[model samples]
Target chain A: MNKDYLNSDIKFNKEVFKTPENYFDNVKEQIYAKTIENKDGQMQSRVALWTIVKPQLSLVASFAIIFFIALFVIDKTKEITPILGTADTSSYIYTIEEGFLKTNFIDFIDPSDSSNYREEIPQDQLAEYIKDNIDIITIALLD
Target chain B: MTDRDIIDGLMNNGNRDHLFRLIVDKFSERLYWHVRKMVVYHEDANDILQNTFIKAWRSLDSFRGESGLYTWLYRIATNESLTFLKRDKIKTFFSFTDSYKNVEDRLNADPYFSGDETQKLLYKAILSLPPKQRAVFKMRYFDDMKYEEISEVLNTSVGALKASYHHAYQKIQKIIEDSV
Candidate 1:
């Protein structure tokens, strides 16, 4: 076992071991089988389409429900109710004119005189005003 | 087939399994011996070799041809063997007086080990070195691998590997000379 002797002897024995009979063949199959088993396990563990999409579907449904509820609440709040037991002709007419003017024109100009711009006009005053307002009808008839 | 051909086949969906089988058939023996020399037991070497291929199969898509396929495989095999040795060392630390004594006993009792007295002595000398140096010596001496290739597998510089192999050789020579 001298150093030089050992070095020389090492060159003599290129291969000095043994394995089981047909080890290469058996090991290849063993490795393939193991790989196949792992592949199958991986496939089994994959996330399904339903699993991924279910949460997204739920989120969309929740958003839709919230949007509809908001719309319903807004519509209910926007409903106009007339004051009970009162013939409020001027106020009702003003509300309808305001809505029509908002929808039809960018700017509104009131033609009524500022002194006559009353919030509440009595039903009698309205009837008298309609009876006396013959000039617009006469002009239309003449045309 | 060439390494590139094997890699191309592995990248293909239809031929991946077949090419992987070819890879196993072609390189298993070389990797087995490489791992066997490090662990010194057939069963341990067998486990390490299997783990190496399984790891290669799992990571084949990410290989990117950064190194030769065989070199990459060798890197995996070497790492698996070294990891096995480290784990075994930790176990021996808790249970035995000396880690190499356990390996020597395993070597002596291993049914697959049929080396003569001189070969056994040589193996013992090699095993007495630290695991990393032992790896360098095994790859350089037994496998006839170049320092550059060993560098790729161990991630050490060629100069460092050469120095490690030289130190391993001197220690092994001294051990064998003393046992004479």
Candidate 2:
């Protein structure tokens, strides 16, 4: 028969492991005392709670940072981007084109047609028009 | 006192400290031995056992009673032992010049260890096994722990644990044979 290596007859059993006299009792007292100390101080519990919460807190923090960065990038984009959604571009285009035509369309008109378009205005009415629109004309010129 | 009583005592806010004492009284020695066999030193085992209970006490609220209290505590003790073993292995790796001879010498020098030469050799062979495998073998062979319960404690499949124990057994047998 193969030697029963794990049998107690080998004297290599659990009995070979021993502790000091009153070790168990003393250890119990030590554990109880330490736990009681923990209860009174509550520091160990707090530290344990910190260890458990630390990783989750880091994850939350990382998300918060990403969220803020996304928010900041979005805000920057909004600052540089034009407004979106149902803007009445036809009216805006007409107004812009009207201004452009008023300033520069004379160049595109035929010289013969331009002579016909030259209706004389009364000096007094022209003066009134200039007075009424002087601020806009001055601002446009400045721009 | 029954584990139920202990659980009930821990659950009740009125007498948690008293119940914790019961817990200490109940599981300390078993946890100590479970740790002691792995580390093979009483002081290290004592420290690990204390940390295990202290950890248990701190996490009592998370215990859902899914497993028996002993199993839960055994799991904690096993994890603590493994962690200690890993840290000790790293600390000693650079300085561990003589390997198994150091283990035998350490065992021989331990005042609490009263084993004969054969027992020392057995322990030396055992300690030579990798830490986790040593734990598997000790749990099964010495503590008579069931593979299922060890699976729960180790969070390993029972098949893997059986294989690990078999391999550990073969290795220890070989080491002892060679040494003899």
Candidate 3:
């Protein structure tokens, strides 16, 4: 409608317009400066912090564990299995005799292992002794 | 050259007066209108437009070719304009009456801003809207911006903008019907 509102019906207070030309010039200078800093040939390198802490602790811990484990693995590989049940070995008989006296035959066995009683009693001997020494059980009971 | 070529030349540190001027010539009036609708003042629009260019020029180094250059520039200008609005709102809230007084002054001075008797009812309906919804409405209708572009600028969903616009139109329609 040509019956629209009047120009006098509104007012726009104009703000001051100042050229900020200096700002652009300053920013360009700063960018150029930063670019120059990037190009400087100082072979700029930062000391690797994680590289030191990570690998060094890992090496120490790993090797310490490995040293213990190498000794373990090598010791394990060289292990004799104590010749316990071998035909020429008398250790099974020694263990049975020791068990008869209730003394540990493998007393000098690895103390670092969790348990103190390290000797493995012969199953067959144990069964036989259990059958034959029913009186030993009764004595233990009476006592 | 076009804005794209100008931006390219500027980023490469080559001659860019033609490009910059092309931008100023092609977009300045449209951008002026967009800014004017939000701020409702020619002066604030001028400040926002100048600041927008300065930012675009400075950040041209890190422009990264992510979106169209003008779209990126528009993003900055929109943020600048909204931030200005927020700051002005804080200043206006010192006396609540003063805020409406400012609006009253604008309605008295500008002719392109006229809404009829129905439009008066509509303005009241719109003024009652939350600031974000009001902004979405202004951008969608006054500036004729695409929902996708508005979404990029507002970091809102297109669905949300559409809903806000639909709600705004419905509310205006309802208010006008009531006036009759």
- Measured by DockQ, the strongest candidate is 2
List model 2 lDDT by residue over B77-126, tens digit each. 89988987776665455443677667777887899888888888888888
Q: Given candidate 2, what's the lDDT at residue B180? A: 70
lDDT of 2 by residue, A1-143 (tens): 55556563454456888999999999887777767665642322222435545666788899999999999999988865653432456556777878853333334556666465545545675676678779977998999
Chain B alone, model 3: TM-score? 0.75
Runs in model 1 lying further than 4 Å from the true structure: A12-15, A40-143
What is every candidate's C-alpha DockQ against the true complex, given to 2 decimals? 0.16, 0.19, 0.01
Cα RMSD (angstroms) for every candidate in the order listed: 19.7, 13.1, 18.3
Question: Compared with the true structure, what per-residue lDDT tens digits does model 3 show for residues B31-107?
Answer: 65566556555556656766666655555567766677667767777787787666565545533455555665665
Global CA lDDT computed for model 3: 0.59
Residue B25 displacement (Å), model 2: 0.9
In the predicted model 2, the residue pairs found to clash are none
DockQ of 1: 0.16
lDDT of 3 by residue, A17-126 (tens): 12234633443334333332333313213234454356566767988997998898878766556553463446556767677534432344575777735246566766
Please state the error at residue A51 of candidate 2 in Å. 21
**What lDDT is obtained when candidate 1 is compared to the true structure?**
0.75
lDDT per residue for candidate 1 within B75-176, as digits (tens), equals 899998887776665555545367667668978988888788778888888767777988998888877888887887788999899899888888888877
Candidate 2, residue B34: lDDT: 81
